[model samples]
Target: MKGPALRGDLVTPSDARYERARVAYWAQFDEVRPSAVAYCETPADVAACLAFCQDAGIPAVPRSGGHSLGGYSTTDGLVVDVSRMSRVGVRRAGDGITAVVGAGARQVDSLAALWKEGVVVPGGMCPTVSAGGFVSGGGFGWLTRRYGMASDHVLAAQVVLADGRVVRCSESVEPDLFWALRGAGGGNFGVITEYEMRPRRVPTIVSFHLRWPWDAAQAVIAAWQRWIIDGPDDLGSAMSVTAVGGDPATVDVAGGWLGDPAALERHLDELVGDAGRRPEIRTVQEDSYLDTMMAAFGLTDTTAGQRQWTGQNPDAVIPRQHFAVDRSVLVDRPIPLTGIGEVLAAFEREPRPGQVRLLSFFALGGQVNRVPRTASAYVHRDAQFYLAFWVGLDRDLPDEGDRHAAQTWADDGFAVIDRYSGGEAYQNFIDPALGGWREAYYGENYSRLAEVKRTYDPHGFFRFAQSIG
Candidate 1:
């Protein structure tokens, strides 16, 4: 059979930009070489690429921000790149604010636009992560504790299915597809063209960071768990223990609160009182919600417009290129103090000379847990916190032994935490090493998601190693 004619720009191996286009955010997957990259500028272009790939019997994958940790966005056959279709704006629906975001729109672009309208949506902290996979896979961030996951705010979406069918789905239309799209909707169903999100009013936030020495790691973690268990919905926080290149470990708690500075101070005081000690350093600042986001992305030191929504210095962006491996688990309850010590011990293990290790705990619960388990495809609504074990290797490390050492360290750390984990994981993190990932990522929702997979993609055309069905 003859392949469908291409409508968008087809970048073959002979093209000058093919090499750069094939690279993902993580340097570890730089070896994946697609046969061709189709840059789609419209929904029709997406449908055309799907038709061509289906006719040619070629495996195809969609690429937006290209931040897939498992490299699911790149295939050996065809790649539909939607990074060129990025557009973000606010549309007025009656007296409400609706955010119109293209699938390729980056978090920085969307957040900056929404900030100008005095509204914000829950999104990942990374500036360049695309809304396509992030919202579909149930995104979370600083605002999650107060507002809920990013997927909860999605009002609708436009998708191009495997058979070249273009459709708009929401609660009122194609309800089953809408249910699956909320949480497990990575690239499993189709290529997302755009998203319609409901925005919430932005409030004056108190951003704070408290740091303690390596010796206080256990105490800080123990106190954090107790504090977040009963913390207010307006307070969102995360605790991180980081060790860089054989350096001593550093423990820090950082986050933003949606209320006044006084309320935030009292919360901090309670945390310190529980820990029975004072942090070595602490800083709190009351700023606009946009500035707090800017600080999280490491853009606070940049020029004025670059840190705010002034429509200037738009080109000042951060590039994330690192050889990293990360594994995560969701905990339904706080780990015992002894288990916390074991986790800290794993962090203390010496990595390679140029390797950095991080153990992070993202606070959950509050509004996040108010939703029922079966309310959406996301089954981890009962989880209290999300924990991640990450290790970064310097790209310049030439020794194969050093790379293996870094991997071993990361795996060992993950194993230590897995013992106390709630046996569930976040779909957005996408771990390739996980076994029985269907049950791990989606608990009771796995069977339903697989059924949805059959209904939409019976031929299993949109698939990766860990994709549904």
Candidate 2:
């Protein structure tokens, strides 16, 4: 069947820019070529694209930051690229501030804009991630412990539904749709045009990083789990074990505290002291909330187009281009010491040259758990921490065998941790290989989300491999 005419900028496979337009952040998905890429400029343009896809019986997917780890953003039919729709503005509301962010706005640009107003919306660390997917998929960041997930701050949204109808949803209007939008709204129910988010006042923060030798992995992991589980809400941290190619593994802990430098230092001292191993490298600095965010993004170097602060070099922006696969699980209880050793052993079993392996534990709880599981579409509120196993091969490597090996290692690593994960997963880090995803991602909320899906997207128009319906 012939597809209907699309009004927005359409790039076919024959177009000169098709190759670039069709590419996603993860190179593993580059092989999934689409019929065409449509850059939607406005809500009307989005409607037009969806209408065309429906008329011609073609699948349509929305691409904002192109950061879907599961490659759900790319489709074989039509890709609605909203990256060009990025725009941000602020307004005063009673005693607080609210920012109207375009769905396509990147995290860095959004942060820079909001910083000028001395406010911020908790978001992911990656700069190029779009507000659309990040917020809808339960976004988290430095302020997460204090303010909760990014989805919690959303006040309203402008969504273009499956029937090509634009509607406004919020607590007072289209409340059911608004509830679904809070967490699992990723490309399933509609195309979001804009988000009205409540921003919190930027507070002074102390950012720190500490590193210990790989041999202390067990001790550090044990100590970290005990400390962070009961840590104050003012603190948020992540512990990771990483190995690049055949290099020795290293354990690193990094985080930020929304308080005085001296207090943070004391806390860090206790953390290290508990682990019974002094870190070879420890660095802590007090900076404005904006600078701390910049540092967290690995943007402390001078670079073109980056605004320079008084004390630091221009921040360097790294493009998201790599061949990687990640799988994650939510930990409700502390993992046993033997289980932790088993996880480390899996990484040691397959040490592929030129492949990077990372196992990360992101601290959850605090205000994130204060919200009830049934309050919104995000159901992992009771999880203590999120565990992810990531494997990345050099994109330049042409050997398919090496890529397959890296993927296998990642899969095996996840299996080891899955045994202790309480069978819960974060919806944001969607995994394609995961079985029983409906229960894993949404839990009891799946039924309601499916009902919402049926109401708004009865035809199953907006869908991917693991879509809600």
Candidate 3:
């Protein structure tokens, strides 16, 4: 039987665009060639694509920025690529500004557009990550500690359901679905076309990057945790130890501060005192909100219009990952120095010849935890910080054996930190290998999410690996 007609363009296998269209952010899924890719341009386009997939008996997956760590953005079936729907607008809502953002809007574009209006949203640092997947998976970043997750600021959304009905959901309308969409994770419910978000207003920000010798990794990790755990909510920080190829590991701390430069310096001084070592490299600047965000991703030198994947725009500079193995844990309690040592030791082990290993800690709490776990579907309100371990292969030297070894290293490293994890993981990271993901991602809210899943997609049309059952 033939499928329903769609207004959007469809790229079939024979089309010249097929090869590029089928690729996701991570090259790991580069071989996942779908029957056709539907480049959705409107809600009607999304509805038509979903109906066609149903009529044709083919699985459909939504592709936004194509940044799914587990490669869930593309599939072997039909792909609803919404990258063409990128649009962002801001309007006054009482005393605040509401950002009307398209689901396919890239984080960099959205940030740049909103910054022009003197407002910002909590979003990831990845320049090319889309609003669709980011907000759906409970987005977090430099602004997260002060404001909250990106989903927390969502005022409303337009979703194209499985039945071809375009519904706008919010706190008052389709409240149950609204609850689930916040943190239930994307691609499980319906395809989001647009979002209405209340963005935070900020006039200035202090951005800083500090680094210490690899020998100070343990002190940095230990003191960083204590500093963030007891620090004010206005502060946001990410501390990481990274080793690329044969280079020695480097311990780095970087983030944005809402306060002035003097206060930020005092905070850094405290951190340095606690760690008992001054940073070997330090760069602090009082910059605009937009500059701080761009600096986070090393895109301060590029224009927002130029910070996309080269596949999307030839002039864009952001490059896609070849392959990666990522694992995460939500730490409610601080890991002792011994456990921290174990984490560092695990990270230093099995250093491959052509791999980049990274261990990151993103501070949680503040406004993120101020909300009750039951307030929304995002239930990890008690976490003090987020701990993640990942290994990426050199794009030039892709190897299946190296990939396997990287996964093994990630698993073992994750195991070390998992001992201190509060039995939860960041849904945004979305690990395919995570055991008990239903509980790890949603915690006490899984049952309610499953119920929402039944209500909206009882037939399991919108399903993927680790989707709500």
- Model number with the top lDDT: 3
Write model 2 residue lDDT over 110-144, tens digit each, in one string.
Answer: 88788888888888778778999999989887778
Best by TM-score: 3
- Tell me the tens digit of each residue's lDDT in model 1 across 277-303: 899999999988887887789876575
Local distance difference test scores for all models: 0.85, 0.86, 0.88
All candidates: TM-score: 0.95, 0.95, 0.97
After TM-score superposition, what is the CA distance of residue 103 in candidate 1 from its true location, in Å?
Answer: 1.2
**Clashes per prediction?**
0, 1, 0
Which pairs clash inside model 1? Answer: none
Q: Once model 1 is optimally superposed onto the true structure by TM-score, how far is the C-alpha of residue 231 displaced, in angstroms? A: 0.4
Task: Give the runs in model 2 whose Cα sits over 4 Å from its true position.
Answer: 1-8, 301-317
The candidate 3 region of ten consecutive residues with least summed lDDT is 1-10
lDDT of 1: 0.85
lDDT of 3 by residue, 111-168 (tens): 8888877788778878889999999888888888899988899999899999989999
User: Model 3: runs farther than 4 Å from truth?
Assistant: 1-4, 93-96, 303-305
Order the candidates by lDDT, highest first: 3, 2, 1
Worst 10 residues of 2 by lDDT: 307-316
